[model samples]
Target: MIRFDNVSVTYGDAAAPAISGVDLTVPEGELVLLVGPSGVGKSTLLGAVSGLVPHFTGGTLRGRVTVGGRDTRTHKPRELADLVGTVGQDPLAHFVTDTVEDELAYGMESLGLAPEVMRRRVEDTLDLLGLAELRDRPIATLSGGQQQRVAIGSVLTPHPRVLVLDEPTSALDPAAAEEVLAVLQRLVHDLGTTVLMAEHRLERVVQYADQVVLLPGPGVAPVVGEPAEVMAASPVYPPVVGLGRLAGWDPLPLSVRDARRRAPGIRERLAGLSPTRTGPEEGDRGADRASVPDGSSGTDRSSATDRPSGRRTFMPLRGASGGRERGSAQAELPEHLAVTTRLGVRRGRAEALRGVGITVGAGETVALMGRNGAGKSTLLSAFVGMVEPASGSVLVGGLTPHRTSPRELVRQVGLVPQEPRDLLYADTVAAECAAADADAGAEPGSCRALVGELLPGVRDATHPRDLSEGQRLALALAVVLTGRPPLLLLDEPTRGLDYAAKARLVVVLQGLARKGHGIVLATHDVELAAELAHRVVILADGEIVADGPTADVVVSSPAFAPQVAKILAPQPWLTVSEVREALR
Candidate 1:
């Protein structure tokens, strides 16, 4: 469907190409999964297909890009609209209509599709997307996932032969992400539509991808192959995959179910290597992270040797006397905030929250999850006193947010929005955090100490707004965390961060949870939730559809379940360490 021959794009004022010398071809109906670290120019490849590269986004193009035998330069996006449909990370930016039905018909109408044809196409798209019931609903009323589905549905009405999506599920909850993936799978099987997509959360989606395209960092050639080879040998992979490689399996399994079915012998081998749990890796995740020194980090890193010629024990944590519980949070502290009751909220004409409720006991960590538009943010905003619900109330440390002034509440419940750039306006990272300290009545020295520790190497002179997306996110979070708010609300906290940075955030949030600060992490990365959250909550149509222990909620839901590995081990496993623990 699309082809790249010796393609290289060097953007404005840059010394080298963002992506250099890449040659690739896409057949008529192949779904290719593009995987890589951030800033690797994955978007550059998509831009080439859409005529954004060397056109809308200025740069020098060195080779030809062909879509359906038509040069992208000649057949711009408008010209190729009937052949390709593209969706991006921020779905809201691409919306062209007020409601779901209108948006779906917008693309068709632009093609001069006849009224009868347009109507049928729109209705068919609504049904295909499982969005018929929401056909007339305002676009703003949908969840992040629903909006994303609408975004794809809108473009697909033209029946484009190819679809390109960039991190489309970054902001959706587990269930919604699954729905989107399932919908894509059905489309590929039924309509024969080809797909090219980029995603970071591999543990959830890698099992089903047809092919994986790895764009190694900036200025490197992309590597493409089948799932196991690309991921098992992946320099950039989730920790669980690392555990799988250490297990000495002939072929590394992509999902936990695959890991468990082959684990009986793997378990015995793991026990021989190390009978007890070990601490985290010393350095950043590298080929070296797998290179454990003195079998120290390896007391349980892997089970590569087949019993060292003989040994066995599948679920090691079950029998270990000293290993810690996988999902265990630290003992409580009296200083942390305690939350109880609901935060009522309304967005325009929609009743986003109708007697919706939540509780965060001191030092507990709770993950807020639900399909898009299920009122996660609205509820978060209400909790922080940013939005006023029509009724009900929120108590932070036994005090109503409504009773506290906006400025006063700022020091009580700290909240971070989905987009980091929106809340940041400071010229320097130092200045941004200093202001937060001022608002919280915290000492200037203390604020600087907090920022430096959270994002080490960051100085007072660094411009907060000028940093990379991950840096900006970290900076914004530092400003919020500086408030010393007993209760913390983070909305998609790790959206653009890399693996090392994500690990740092987990450490920070977990540390806070250990210190007895009530924490609510509203996110779509189920793996993260499983690893970090003590409990999980699911919402749909603005109500708490399910709430309980993380394992219970994840195991019970068909769509929201955690990785297959967690479900397999007889002993509970949350993080990759636990998976290793269970194997040992």
Candidate 2:
């Protein structure tokens, strides 16, 4: 139902096309996954299908793009609204109504559908996406993941023939992501709907795609093939595929189930070899308290300790001062960079966090995980002083966060929020970095250097708005790091990054941790937690449900386990790198 003939898209006065030499035919009722590294024009290609390219986006589109045999070149986005549904990377930007129910019905209303049909479709969509409980919630009050589901439900309510989605599950938890993907599967199989999706979290969606379209790089010809064939040699892939490649499995497995079917031999080969844990020892604070079997002993119980009945409350940090003497302050800083005791936060008649207690030590990385609206982001906000606690206390570098001045807070903590663009206002990347350095009183090249290390190939002259979602996230992270705070907080840090960029990020964060920086990231990327985090903290309904060693917390929970852990189950392995290192 969708065709791209010799397609090439280029923005104004660029050195080359953002994407070029693209040609493919997507049959009706099939789901096509667009795979590539960040900033490779996957979004551009998806835009072309929905008639946003060269029309609403003000880009030059070469060749032809047709949907349902209707030429996209001649049809504007509004004209094709009935036939096409497009959800961009940012869900907040897609909303046209205030409440969940309104947003879902707005699309159908725009299409001039009958009142009865719109009401039925809206209810069906709310149930399909698990948004029934949030039907009356305002769009602005919902969590990022909730907003994503609402955006998708809005599109689905219109009953369009084609669905073009960019990172549909980026903000969702594993179970919610599965629910949304399952709905897509039903639409494709039961209703003959066409879906073209671009996502960075390949681990979540690769197994569900009907076909894979691989975009190698900017201006490079596209490669189209079966999911397994394309992923075998594709530069970017999920952890399960990487594990399959490492084990020399034929026709590399796309899902954990497939890998498990072939894992018996590898399991025996890895016997007596323990997975590597390079971070703090188990004796450190926040370590699993239960007498779980260590990997070295060849016992693979994979069970982490349950939540402690009596949570530990830390004393406030000491010697924290707002002064110009950076060296003196660094020496006086306590081991606990951040501490929260029975923290409670309320937002708009809802308790966002309840009785939450956590701690972050110097040179340690902790991952905050949970389902959508699970209070993960709210906890991050509490740390950064974005939200005031309704009860209990929060201390960062020995000082209360909400009571501290903005200038002093920058010296103690920094946060990269879920929406990276919120921290960037400069026109160009160079200007943003310069401003960051100036604000933090750092060396001239400080922020620029971090950007170079975290995200290579980002031009200094590139506009922040023009960059892809992943690139924008990296730039925002670099800006936050410019201040060189003792504690760093990241919300959905890997939202748009591919495997390669994410690896670079892991390396950079690891280096920071080695240098005594405390990092707390709120994310749904279990692979990232497995690869980089020393501790895992799970939240549920505004409360801490699980907090322990990374392996223990994730391996035991089927919903949050990484692909590598799921495949290598009955073994304590968490990542392909850990397995490779153990074998070596």
Candidate 3:
């Protein structure tokens, strides 16, 4: 249905082409997953399908891209609206209406469909995406994940033959992501629709893909093959694939069921060895004393101000017989850094958060997880004073966040919001770094250096808007970290990040935690939480339902468990690293 013949795209002022010599074909009624590292032209490749490339993006097209035998060069995006439905990474940018129902119907109206037909399609889409309850809510009042679903429903309502999605499930929780993927499966199997999706969270979508397209990097030809073949050598992959490779399986398992069928052999090899559990050291109470600005032990402080200043030291724990330890108390305890009491937040008539209470500790990484519209983003907003609490109080270092001034807040806390573009306004990356340096009062080139650490080889002259979703996120994170705030908050930090980029993020965040930085991130990436988070907090209907150590929280909830945890049931292992260590 979609064909790229010797395709190459180069934007103005770019030294290299975004994509080059990409000759590929996606058969009709099949789901093709586009995979690659950050900024490797996955988005650019998707844009070519919907006629967004070299059209609305202002780039030069060297070769032809066709959808349904219709050349994109001859058909602009508007002309191909009925044939192709494209949803970008930022859903808010795609909406033209105020309410969920209106947004879903907007595309059908544009296509000049009958009113009755449009209404029925809108209702079907709302039910298919589980957006029926949110149909009357205004787009502005909805959460990031809700907005993403609305954007997808809006496109789906049009009933286009081809659907192009960029990070379609990035903002969705595990359950919601499953719903979206199931809907896509139905479209491919029952309706004969073609889906070309580019996503960074391979763990969520790899098994569902009919085929895989791996773009190694810029200027490198893409490799298209079976999912297993591509992931074996692909720079980015899911944990299950990593486990299969480690176990020397003949064919790498794509799903948990397949992995479990082969798990008996591996389980026997490490029969009595217990999984290693790592966390904050016990009896190291003074480890974070320097993080308290006033040297007070009480939780009266509003925010933390001590920046992360040291490296992390890892120590392995063993039993008396020199075997790995399990169910240790030190691995589950948290050193408190900030606490909230009966927090309540209201946005207009909506109770975004109600009696939400949680604590974050220095050197601890806590993941806030829930379904869409569950107040994860709202809670994060309250921590940074972007949203004021209506009833309860929040105490960071010793002060209330809403009462703190912007100048002081930058030193106390840093937030990488859901919309990375909201933190960027400068034209070029160099300018953005300079502005961040001035705002944070950091040394010259400090922000730029941080950006390099997160995203290497990106040109200083590149426009911030021109960068990929993951690159933009990295730049925003660097801009926020320039202040070296003791508390760091991230909302969907891995929205567009590939495995390589996410690995780098894990290392950076771990380093910051070792240096006494308290990290609270609201995310839908379960693999990330399993690998990095020390604790997990699950929110639902604007209230906290569960909070505990990572292994306990995730393993108890089937929807939130990682691939490894699910495959190795009856075992306490949460990650591939844990399994590998146990085997060793």
Candidate 3 lDDT score at position 98 = 88
lDDT of 3 by residue, 312-348 (tens): 1111111111111221212322356578999999877
1-584 per-residue lDDT for model 1 (tens digits)? 78999999987766567788889887777788888765577887888988877777778888889988989877767888888898876677798778899999999888898999999988888876678989988876676667778897888888888898877667766666767788788778888888888777776577878888898876788898988898866666765576677666667788777777776765554443432322121212122211111100001111111123121111111111221222232221244364535645677777887767777766577888877777787677666655555777777655566566544444346666666655566687766665555544445654566555556655577666434456677876766665445577888887766565677677766655544557888887776777777788887777898888787777666566555435344444445666566554
Question: Model 2: what TM-score?
Answer: 0.92
Off by over 4 Å in 3: 281-336
lDDT of each: 0.67, 0.84, 0.81
Please give the distance, in angstroms, between residue 333's alpha carbon in candidate 3 and its true position after superposition: 18
Worst 10 residues of 3 by lDDT: 311-320
TM-score of each: 0.80, 0.92, 0.90
Best model per lDDT: 2
The most accurate candidate by TM-score is 2
